[model samples]
Target: MAPTLRLLAAELARRCDQDGPHADGTGTGGVAEMERAALLPPGKLLRPLLFTESAAATGMRRADTLAAALGVERLHVGSLVHDDVIDGDTQRRGRPSVVARYGLPNAIVTGDALLIGAFREVAAHTPASVPDARRLAVVQTLAEAGVDLCRGQAMEDELRAQGDRDVDRYLRMISLKTGALFRASCLGGAQLAGAPAAAQHALTRYAEHLGRAFQMADDLLPHTSDTATSGKSALSDLRNARPTFPVLLCWHRTNEQGRAQLSALLAGTLPAETAMETLRVLLRESGALTQARAAARAEAAQAKAALDELPATEARAALHAVADLAVDRDR
Candidate 1:
């Protein structure tokens, strides 16, 4: 991470530790605080990094920009907390997940607390130079992103239940689930910098494509990386029977025998470990892994192209690097 981003991440972590309501009724020093703190620990901080970098690209690095960045990070962390619960994941970043440590109900409340803290952080700390109307716009952006995020999560659940294989539908769902916040992060920074509408639109597109690339790469991690490398169980997605990009692509490209094997695995007819091993083989043999990687690389290229519309600067160069990072990250 760059020095500025590292500083911003540290500040955001401090804020998360200090601002939220305690999980325990005592309001301090309890399991709730511990859970909240655990969730906010240093990680990629990708959303906030995007926000700060976007703001910098617009030649704006005001206090409000940092505040917006922090807000986005909080929202991202909250989503992860809830995602672990929904996926029944017991591990995150190589540690026991909040759901695993505190149980589901507490984890739910912990996520909600972080979300509420995100709004409060935005409302209280947006730069003083920003006018009231612009600040309100930033708040509205966060609110809409949150709504779309929930809708996407629900859509994912429905798709999983129905075992939908339409790649386009999956793309749209991920755009909502993952891309919405990325869009919001970029928009918040641009808005904070008071960039014109054209620039904001460009950054939004950059974020959208970059987000898709990030998620697609992430979807491949279970097949390509181990638990130690990826920081979560490799079988988590398979265990939940989630129809990830690789799985769907493999299904579409493979022979009937391969499809039947995948179906049996997803239907829980095969042992979990054996099923995952078979699915991995099927994906590799069908060229689905290669295709999925190509898709991610294509999205990253689109993201970089979008940066061309922005004013040329070192920040823009950094954003270009971010696009590469999205697809190339190992974890």
Candidate 2:
């Protein structure tokens, strides 16, 4: 891990590892325990890394962004908890999901706790060097991104239900669901450091593309990578009938006969094994996975290019490295 990331790991432990009493002065609720499982020694910690490196790129010390970084990580894990419940996913990061271990109600509460607690963490733990107004701005940025996350998830549900495959709609949904939060990570860091508008804009652009690239690679994992690497079941997207990047790309670019067959496969009209095999063949023959991979690389390149606006620094290089890491998940 990077030195800054090591520092972040320690900060996460110090802050997020606590187990306080529940309401009515009762003993610690298992919620705290569940939260610890979700957060401690976080996997990848990419959002936190983005926020901190963004601050670093703005000439702030790495340590100063710890609160901001952990806050985002908390929020990210909360979303994942809720996502596992919604998707009926039993596993996360090669372990049982919160819902799998704690049951649905407790998982729901755990997610809500972290989702709201993250905002509190930011509001209460901001560095003293940051002015009140910028602090408020960071909180506002996070709140708005949270709202966008909901909107995007709703949009994704609608698209899947209606079997809509417009490429632009898919792009817009991801920009909201995935890109908004990623953008917030960089924006929060820049805001904390009192960065000028131009620098903030550049980092925002970097994060936006990085998020898209990340989601694109994620969408491809079922098709291109092993189940162990993805930490999810095989052909998970197909199982869920999600209109992911490669799916929509194949839909848009395939011929009429292929579209008819693909639609049948996605509509769950075909036999399970047959649909999986035929769709896999369709995806390969259409080159949708290759196209999606190229698109992911393009977005990563755009994220790297956005760094040019910032002054050359180790922090900026770290930001570039993160952009590469986003797409590297597929490998």
Candidate 3:
């Protein structure tokens, strides 16, 4: 990990430990304990890293910037906890999920507590140089992103129920579900730094593209990587009857027979393992996998292009590397 990422992780762990209701020793202790476990290992730390690097690129590095980074990460972890409960996922990052370790109620409460803790962490931020109004803007950015995330998730559920396969719709859903937070991370970092509006807009666009690429790559994982490599169950999306990028691309490109197979698989009429194999073969043979990969690469390219507006700095270079990692990683 980069030094900045390490710093962000350490600070995030410290914030998680120090804030919230942990001191009460009541049931809140359980929430705090779960928060530490969920956040401390700090999978990727991409959101915080994005925020920190964005701040650095804008020539602003403060304790409050780190706090804002932690705030985005907390929101992310809370989303994951709630997602696990909704998806009935028993595992995350190769360990039992919060819902699996504790009961559903605990997982839900823990997720809510994390969100509250995120606000508390942000509220406590008082950068000596930054004004209170700017700090409040950061908080508002987070709040709006949270709303977008919930709207995205709800839209996704509705789409899944309708068996929607439109690529445009899928992109819009992911823009909200995944891209919103990425946007917030970059925007909040810039806001904390009191960056000019143009720079902030550029970073926001960069984050949007990066987030789309990140999710596109994630949608490919079930078919391209195994459980150990991906840190997720193989064909888990298929089992849940969710339509991902590769699946939708395959649907668009394949023959009528292939479409029937996909429909059966998605409708739960076909056996899951058999459907998974059939879809994988269809995706690979029909050029959907290549197309999906191309789409991810295109998005990453656009993300990098958005950075052209920023000053050339090591922090900007770090952001470039993050865009690469967004699509290149297996997990």
The regions of model 2 sitting more than 4 angstroms off are: 22-29, 270-274
Tens digits of per-residue lDDT for model 3, 1-331: 2888878878877766665653455644566788777786888889988988888889886445787788888999999999989988888888888999998999998899888777766778646567888888989999999999999999888889999989999999999999999999999989888899999999999999999999999999988788887777775688788879999999999999989888898988878788888888999999999999999999999999999999999999999999998888889
Candidate 2 weakest ten by summed lDDT: 18-27
The best-first sequence of candidates by lDDT reads 3, 2, 1
Q: Compute each candidate's TM-score over C-alphas.
A: 0.95, 0.95, 0.96
Q: All models: lDDT?
A: 0.85, 0.87, 0.87
Error of 3 at 303 (Å): 0.6
State residue 32's C-alpha deviation in candidate 3, in Å.
0.9
What candidate 3 gets wrong by more than 4 Å, as runs, is 19-28, 62-64
Residue 153 miss distance in model 3 (angstroms): 0.6
User: Residue by residue across 236-325, what tens digits does model 2's lDDT show?
Assistant: 577678889988898878899989998888788877677878987888999998999899999999999999999999999888888788
Clashing pairs in 1: 64-127
Candidate 2: residue pairs that collide: none
Whichever of 1 and 3 has more lDDT, that candidate is 3
The residue-level lDDT of candidate 3 at 216 comes to: 98
What local lDDT does model 2 show for residue 215? Answer: 96
* Per-residue accuracy of model 1 over 10-127 as CA lDDT, tens digit each: 7866765664454455666554475456555667878888888888889886344787788787788888899998889998898888889888888888888778777876788886
lDDT of 3 at 51: 86
